[model samples]
Target: MHEFSLVKSLLRQVNEIAEQHGATCVEEVKIEIGPLTGVEKILVQEAFELLSPDLPGSDCRLTIIEVPLQAICNSCGKSIVVQNFQFQCTACGSSNIRITSGDAFRLLDVTIDTELTTGVTEP
Candidate 1:
């Protein structure tokens, strides 16, 4: 599944971030996945769970937030929230449309448990 590759990339980025901060373990990872991203949430989660132990961030949990696809109708000048893979405009039944969102697959944030030395000072 494509989700495997996607999760692989995501975990790689997480590993980089954790290493940058000298983290001992990753606590959580939050990501936003749009409907038009073509990545299935269930498959991604399964892949993450299956691969978490072997990665740098062991025992980390992945949280996915689904975003709705939106488009602007070219013919009717209407804003449409696409549902069920329908690209037609709701206002004038126009097929001409420009997608605005719902094609995003991005990592929002990562929470990590970093090692702290005794009385470490920050600049």
Candidate 2:
């Protein structure tokens, strides 16, 4: 499944981020996915479960946020949420519409655990 590749890429990104911050452990990774993204949530989860263990912080948790497909009606000049993948404008009943969001997979944020050090001075 394509989800495997996507999840692999995601883990790679997370690994890079964790390294950049000198994180001891990766705690969580959050992502936003929409219907238009053509990505199945369950498949992505499975892929992550299978592939994440090979990378650092194998215990990292993945959070998937579902967002609705949003678009702006060029005919009515109204912003609306597209339902049933219909490209027509609800208010004007026109086919002229511009998609605004919910079209791609987006990485929201990553949470990591880091080590903190404090220097002590002895007089």
Output the number of the TM-score-best candidate: 2
Candidate 1 weakest ten by summed lDDT: 51-60
Question: What lDDT is obtained when candidate 2 is compared to the true structure?
Answer: 0.87
Question: Per-residue alpha-carbon lDDT of model 1 for 1-123, expressed as tens digits?
Answer: 799988889989988888898888899999998889999889999999988886554678888988899999999898899989988998899999999888888899999886678789776
> Looking at candidate 1, what is the lDDT of residue 11?
86
Name the runs in model 1 displaced over 4 angstroms: 74-78, 118-123
Give each model a TM-score.
0.80, 0.90
Best by lDDT: 1
> What are the Cα lDDT values of the candidates?
0.88, 0.87
Write candidate 2's Cα lDDT for 1-123 as tens digits: 788888888888888888998888888889999989999999998898888786566677889999999999988899988999988888888899998889888899998877776665445
- Show the colliding residue pairs in model 2: none
